[model samples]
Target: MPRLSTRTRLLLITTFPLLVLFVTLTWYSHQSRQEEVRAELAERGQLLAAALASSGEASLMGGQFDELKASIYGMMQGDSAIKRVTLLDASRKPLVDVEARTSGQPEARYFEAPIHKRLLYVTGGGDRNVGTMGYVQVRMSATALLAKQRRRFYIELGVASLGLLLCLSLAYRMTDGFAASLKSSMQALRAADEEKRRLLQRVNTAVEDERKSIALEIHDELNATLIAVRLEAQQITALAAQAQPAPLAGQIGDKARAITRLALGLYNSGRSLVRRLRPEVLDMLGLQGALEEMVNQYERNHPDCHFALQAQGDFAGLDGNVAISAYRIVQEALSNIVKHARARNATVALLRRDGRLEIAVADDGVGFDPAHTAEGIGIAGMKERVQALGGRFAIATANGTRIAISLPLES
Candidate 1:
């Protein structure tokens, strides 16, 4: 046998038993109808035979054959099932015979009743016995009864079949609905899995981009400072070996001061690079103060746009992951506004409400339609990151764009 689908198996499991039960009940009903029909026919036949024998007893004994024959034929005319009736004499000779219409009827059955003399006298009761005077026989055909039984059987069978079909149809519909719902859920799960993979790829890309940026900054700023310091040291060595030391002491001192200045610049460059890699400000000043410093830096860098921060919570003991993500999200949002949105004013909000960190970045700019436009790497990556941390993200745009994020604080 072929393997069945879940839907097919469920339907079979539910409907097979009902089908069997209905069929059994239908067959039983047909048999019971047949029995009842036969029983009724036999009772009717016996009654007709007994009544004829009693009514014709006097006429049969007086040798009045005409009156007895008239009585027998009259009953036969009224009952169409009476195929034949016979009046027998005491010597077993037929005195009268009558038949009713039997056109298109099946084989007949027989019922017999006896005719007893009305005169009864007792002389020696112990050993004397007398038999019945005469006999009456009736033959009946059950055409009508059998026809009724068949009609009843067919009607019952049809009803049972109809009920079975209805039940099966209902069960199939229910299974179909369940199968459809299950299919939809599976499709949704597949889509979510695909989205998760795409988000991971984007995250890796973002990391590579950050590394490249940091490498470029170090190469351009720190290397040049180190080369300048090396040139100053060589000059100091040349002046030290000079025979006229007093005359060139001022030159040596100037060279020493230049090297000192270059060393200080190189130190500042190293600190900036370290801050970019892992914000030590978050540890020194906490999340709120770090965010304040970040916003102040953005204002200084992007002089064309004004920025503000509204941080209203004790972010002293926040989870490290949540704090870092929140910082990156605000950083990306402000960069997007400065680069894409031709806006003059932007705001960043960080509030701790009900054991959760809520962050919102809003810019009064030429906002783009989210439904029509595809999200850029920054926004998409930010949204995926928040969701990965079991947080919610949303965006709204009318006069400006607002990206809202809510993160559950870890205990």
Candidate 2:
């Protein structure tokens, strides 16, 4: 069976008890109605038997059996509920038997009464004694009354069923409406997430463009000015060698050497800034070479730590977004490993699997709980880059902190 939604399941859970109570109450009411009908039938049977017994006693004592028979037949003719009537002598021997010849099968209820007359005591003490004359037994038919009750019960059951169905329909409608509302809300949230990803991707693109522009400006303007200063200082050193006074010439040569040193140092610093702003190596070497170069630089910087790179599959002609996001994720992971992990060994792996790029960075060092780890380690930025490209990002810290990411390639 298909699984029920939360709303539907809750409705069923809440309704079950009420459903059971309704069934139990319906059955109890039906049984109570049946008992009442039977009791009334029995009461009428008793009253009828007693009345006939009292009236027929005089005729029975006089041996007028014909009148008693006529009286019983007439009573049965008027009342269809009466099934049979029988008169018996004091010895329990039946005298007159009268029955209603009903067409259909009829059920019966029986009642009996003793026929008696008041007689004076033999001692004439003024108190009367009772003498048994005969007995009368009456059986009343309960088929019609019971049938009416059954019909009423059937009607009640049908009404109850209709009400139950109506309630269920209403509940189903409510659940359906709730499910629909929930679905729409979820869809809206998904749409909002997509919009956010698009916006982030645009912002990343703009920022990268600005960085490239700044890098070009520094390479063209600042590097040229520093080179001119270095060239002028070298020319001064050459002129100092041709001066007449040896002491002055030596001192001027020393000052020119120091100025050249400062100019060269500033020039080198400017070149390094250009490289950081936008690494030209990425454009020249592709993702694999760029990553290998990065790992080498980190290893050179921190000789105490050994960094390894394992690259598989072709990285040529990859999408810029895929390459950059992967690069940034590995960059951040390595930075975190060096700064926080206090690791002696770190590994970076890149794979092209099933038209997607998979990147993993791990360090065999101290690990920290992700929940407690500060976002200053650039973990949040890496996750956003992956999410903006609609990829999966995961982190594990079993042995040490490991960041894994997968981004789709534009086919």
lDDT of the candidates, in the order given: 0.80, 0.85
RMSD of 1: 18.8
User: Which regions of candidate 2 fall more than 4 Å away from where they truly are?
Assistant: 1-167
lDDT of 1 by residue, 78-100 (tens): 76667788888777788888776
Clashes of each: 0, 0
Candidate 2: 10-residue stretch with minimal lDDT: 101-110
* Tens-digit lDDT string for candidate 2 (170-239): 8878877787887788789999999999988998788778988999988999889989988999999999
lDDT of 2: 0.85
The best candidate in terms of TM-score: 2
Provide TM-scores for the models.
0.47, 0.62
Output the lDDT of residue 400, model 1.
87
